[model samples]
Target: MSYSNNAVKVFTVDPLNWQPWVETVDVKALTPAQIDVLSEAPGGLEKIGPYYALLAHDPEVLRERTRLFNAVMYGRGGLPRRERELASVAGSRVNGCTYCASVHGRIYNDLTKRTDVIQRIFTEGVDAQLEPRERAVVDFSVALTRSPERVTADDLQPLRDAGLSEAEILDLIHVVAMFAWANRLLQTLGHPTRDEVVLV
Candidate 1:
């Protein structure tokens, strides 16, 4: 597979598979704590994939991480879910995390029914052509992912100008920041492949 960030590749809305580089915890041998943590995670027990299993090595960390993840992504109010998904896609795209991008791209497409935008982003880069509002979200997410230190009040103007409220902008920032962390964990722990990947 091409590792280059700019290389054009097909991105599908369908679930992509991922595999862990390290040995993941065996589901059958899971401890009560690990099972509890995994149960609270996105897919719950039956869907505890290799990634979650690996993290389950430390049930406490995984528990806290799962709680925060669920709250951030599934929380009520503030930014609309679709824009949050868009920000995630932008961050993953910038980080070169194909798996994260594909997953979030699928969510974004499901929410907005705009597969073309995700297709363009995967084919192009974060600078892919998009609507004004989407452009603002993508640009901010890319900037934050590429260089968080360089982002400033000026950087947020575009979001505000695009009609986002302060709360929504804050939500956008949180989503981008979360993806920055999430993408790193995923890419560093494993690699995306078409082989026997644990489908989420």
Candidate 2:
């Protein structure tokens, strides 16, 4: 799919399957003043790097919030990286963030060496093919993303049955919830993809 000159192209997916709300931003167009402002912001230089430079008009608070959110989601989780990526992928899939799904899908495949499963979830539905634990994580993520209000004790059962500890389950929920917010924020603010950044 062709994007605007200022847009970053990350993943090419069937728009009919996963519909993302916003096109990716192109960081190459950022001005020096924007870069200077972003570089000085807390965690801004690292969490988003040059991408934050593209969002020159964005409030500093929003930039810092996104940076902090990503840091926690990708960094502090005690769960296995594979498991965390699974939940992230599943949540992105449910949230219809094609960019996030593709990025996390690659990470999941790399970590688990399970490209087949990753492809299956991306092409088909998450329920199409997954192990017991994987299925539980996918289900929980989907439920949490789609209709969080509908989540009840029954929703946690599968995760519990899959032998996930309370901490893991909580972590899964937090990741899903955080990503849900992050996806919307990125969509609303038109966050740039990694491809958009121009390394200095």
Candidate 3:
């Protein structure tokens, strides 16, 4: 229940039951650059968890990353938040990034209140049987993540057909690509807790 970003508590099961398995950088020993970078963390990095401190090793990149991430994920327009979260889930799943999938799935559920698609994602793939619009977004996300080289402008036809405007299409692409990179970063930087454990 402690909230200090500088403490060195044993990384245990998160109350949310989705803790990062890797050790984060000690928040207290953070350099000035990292401090400055994290000071401007979007959505309050501390509230988001310890991963921001870890990524703060490269304050410049982390700043741009967080800035862009906040704008894309929490922006005013473009794909609906639910669809954006779905794209994150799709990209994370295709990239084999369990942490991103879990977190985004939770957001997807919270926003959409629909577990059927989440279950579909788990049992099948992002391209599982879905409503037409959902299927289009998932397909775009998966294809973009798995084989970016093979993807073409034509690949976005389904989303367009689903009534996504050009701006929404671009936003969806950015969200998917962002998760593709973010998922790889998370997988390489830290593992995630597999079970719930929150005694503290």
TM-score for each of the candidates: 0.90, 0.69, 0.81
Candidate 1 C-alpha error for residue 59, in Å: 1.1
Between candidates 2 and 3, the one scoring higher on TM-score is 3
| Residue-pair clashes per candidate | 0, 0, 0
Residue-wise C-alpha lDDT for candidate 3, range 1-200, written one tens digit per residue: 32233222232112223344455666767778777777887556355355675677688898899889988898997789999998988888777766677778888888987778877887676668999999899998888888889999899899889999999999998998799779878776655554442221
Model 1 earns a TM-score of 0.90
Supply candidate 2's per-residue lDDT for 68.
60
Order of all candidates by lDDT, from best down to worst?
1, 3, 2
Model 2's TM-score against the true structure: 0.69
RMSD of every prediction? 3.5, 6.3, 6.6
Provide the overall lDDT of each model, using Cα atoms, as 2-decimal numbers.
0.82, 0.65, 0.75
What is the per-residue lDDT of model 2 for residues 1-200, given as tens digits with 9 covering 90 to 100? 32344343333332212222333233455556555566666465455433344345564654566566666566664666688788887887776666667767777777877688777877787676788988998998899899988999999999889899898887788788778876665555443343433333
lDDT of 1 at 25: 83
lDDT at residue 113 of model 3 (Cα atoms)? 78
Candidate scoring better on TM-score of 1 and 2: 1
Q: In model 2, how many backbone clashes occur?
A: 0
The digit string of per-residue lDDT tens for model 1 on 90-138 reads: 8988888888888889888888876899989888878888999999999
